[model samples]
Target: MADALPWQQALWQQLASRRQHAHAYLLHGPAGIGKRQLAERLMALLLCQRPTATGACGQCKACQLLAARTHPDHFILEPEEVDKAIRVDQVRELVGFVTQTAQLGGRKVVLLEPAEAMNLNAANALLKSLEEPSGETVLLLVSHQPSRLLPTIKSRCQQQACPLPTRAQSLEWLAGQLPEMAAGEREESLALSAGSPLSALKLHEQGVLAMREQVVEGIKKLHKQQSSPSQLAEGWNGVPLLLLFDWFCDWAHIILRCQMAGEEVDLGAADMHKVLQYLARKSTPSQLLSLQDWLLAHRQKVLGKANLNRVLLLEALLVQWAGLGGKA
Candidate 1:
């Protein structure tokens, strides 16, 4: 049997007990949840020659092949490069693979991860395969954002939504993985990852807690007219662009919330309150809302692989932040 996550035990049992399984199963939910792991385990079960009620039998030839990463019946389709699109050519390759008989004479499994990354042509290509799937084959589409996928593709598959872990569950799993993390650090990481336990551990490993301080301080210095955005951007060039953009977006949301609700934001970051205060004092609610919209648009552009100059991007955003309440 595959090793299921503590939270995945029930879901695993439910899937394993299904009377009739769909050829295409669309597993989706919030990122950093366990959707990928669950899909992988399911794929193993389907490919295993000796799948039991629990799952795959470790002693089978199929299990050994998978363990060695040479399972003939299993295929993975994903972006070759990070943040790149899964192009139509890749889906064409998949079509060729599926038409051939299974090498192992068992079930064939294709795992498409981050299914939303497939470009329009690729998604359309996949739609045909989903509509007319081969016998004894399963296509598992793992998506973090199902809305971005074509409605036709979504309609062809049975959807399996992965639920976010509760606060207690997230903390419990995170503590087990990162026992060395300070209690406050764990809390902050969980908050920053939006309650995804695995993502919280990743944040802890990446030292985001420390880098966040520098980013916040840079924002503060800009607000005080004591720092240059270009210099700040240089200092943070290695930071993940999406993460930085998301933080700025969150900051804008907090400032807007403070103006409208008279409430302090609690992201569990050390200096969030001070940042919120600075933003609240300098920007009107309407101004922050506009900035929020801009940040969101740029975030989408970055995710779409826009080849922007990083320094200029940061400078533009920081300039907007610094000028949020100008009277002009």
Candidate 2:
């Protein structure tokens, strides 16, 4: 098993020392930050017959079964289909799993990965189990957006927030893990990963880093007014719009930092300094906040299966961003 991330370690430590553990826990964080892995580790600890507080002993039978995905007492609930909500039936099934006796005569572990995908009925269905869980049952709910969940559900579970690792730490860890890549390649991989080491390593292995670079460079050109958003959007038919929004958010964060510090801005490989500066000049802090909210709303709409034109959406967003400058 991989070593636990910092947040995971802290959580494990807390669990070990506590005499009374919460029946349900909500692990909330950005996707691909290893929340699922952490939840599995937590399950291993819970199900281990001879468990230590820090982590599970990999040699144990429970741990072995978990590794093989055959742990009878462990159940994972997720959406039935891609982009589909988790239904009330799924939550009802989980309730049945939790109420049943543990096959191993030990703890029962129930994990709801991406719990925020649960629909209103599903969330309400799960709320009763969360409120009155079986004595030996441990419920782990992992969500990328806690705000999307019902307030009653949120209130029932202990919440843990996980943040992405620092760039330096993530890069150093990736270097040790993947030594085949050249130093330059590693640096580029890390940047493309946007502080997620696993994402960086995956992109490097898949040979998709070059494709992402081309897209990012195309975006930079659009930001610089050398190409129109319409022209740039044409080349990225299969690529997700979320990827573009992520790049924009990263660039926006850097620009905001530089603007606040009044520093000599090196937009790095990004070419949006002029556009960002213009917006910064015209917009108040409140307007910037609103712009971020708008972007997030659009992202959610896309994720929720809204039919939106990619090119037109990008163009419309750019227009709004430009309008921020007029306000400033």
Candidate 3:
């Protein structure tokens, strides 16, 4: 994962040129735009016995050890299970690692990804290490939602923002990776990911477009009283809860934009634009706005692993959506 995305080359070069760097760096941005890979590359460069101007030497003993996941001086702290919180014990272990001298007599590197996943205890436990790590220790914190992190944690590290690639850049990169993908399909994937190339590829591969179509149609029927939340939930059980919420958030904005401006600004797909227009006509502007806020809040909840009954939550949201349009 040391391979940098095309858009990352300039930033990588800039970082490489620096003779001295901060003890810790917080790399943050939207999901799946290669923040982890960027962090890994930086770690490799820092730990490589013979680092070049651009990055890691790739042939040094240090580089080989890192490639083999046997680097004694390198540690990674992530949630034990996907979507679970990083507990305090994990951070405590990292603290011990921070105090120890680098086994290789080179720089010690630690990567803490999705830093927002650290619960209050875990976050607090890492503060001392972040504020004063051992000399030559480098901490790279990768986060998709930095806002959720404690202010103390964020304020300690030098922040490096990782922005989503431009639409054209993403399209070009995706085209290279997926040459057999249709032009329209590629565009759709990019749009779905909100300009995150890797995320778009995963969404397309997971067949989210087809699922989104179903969700949209479900919304239409629910608005007309032809469908119930349970019915739609049963149908959408296969769709990832976070992704379903993401699409709804996007559609909520699309409907609001169409109703207010008679055009789609954030959304692509001409057919979906027209469909959103129809829903915009049926739903009141105020309803869409409120629904958008609700969707956003719930999206965050989903990310935080809140104790939510999935079907019931979706049911409640859809019921509120169904109440939109016309006189009601």
Which numbered prediction scores highest in TM-score against the true structure? 1
Candidate 1 residue lDDT tens string, 276-309: 7766887787888788989999998887767888
lDDT, candidate 1, equals 0.83
RMSD of each: 2.0, 4.3, 2.2
Against the true structure, what is each candidate's TM-score?
0.94, 0.77, 0.92
Which residue runs does candidate 3 get wrong by more than 4 Å? Answer: 221-226, 262-271, 326-328
lDDT of 2 by residue, 1-328 (tens): 4467753566667765665667899988777567777787777888877777567888889889988999899999998876677889989999999889999998898999788888778889998899998858989999977888889999999998865777677767777878777877788777766657777777777665667766656655654667665666677665557766776666556556656767636666333555566555556667666667778888887666466887788877766554555521
The global C-alpha lDDT for each of the candidates, from Candidate 1 onward, is: 0.83, 0.74, 0.86
The reply for model 2, stretches above 4 Å from the true place, is 6-8, 17-20, 81-83, 192-194, 203-208, 220-231, 250-294, 303-328
Number of the candidate with higher TM-score, 1 or 2 = 1
* Model 3: ten consecutive residues of lowest lDDT: 319-328
- Compare candidates 2 and 3 on TM-score and give the better one: 3
lDDT ranking, best first? 3, 1, 2
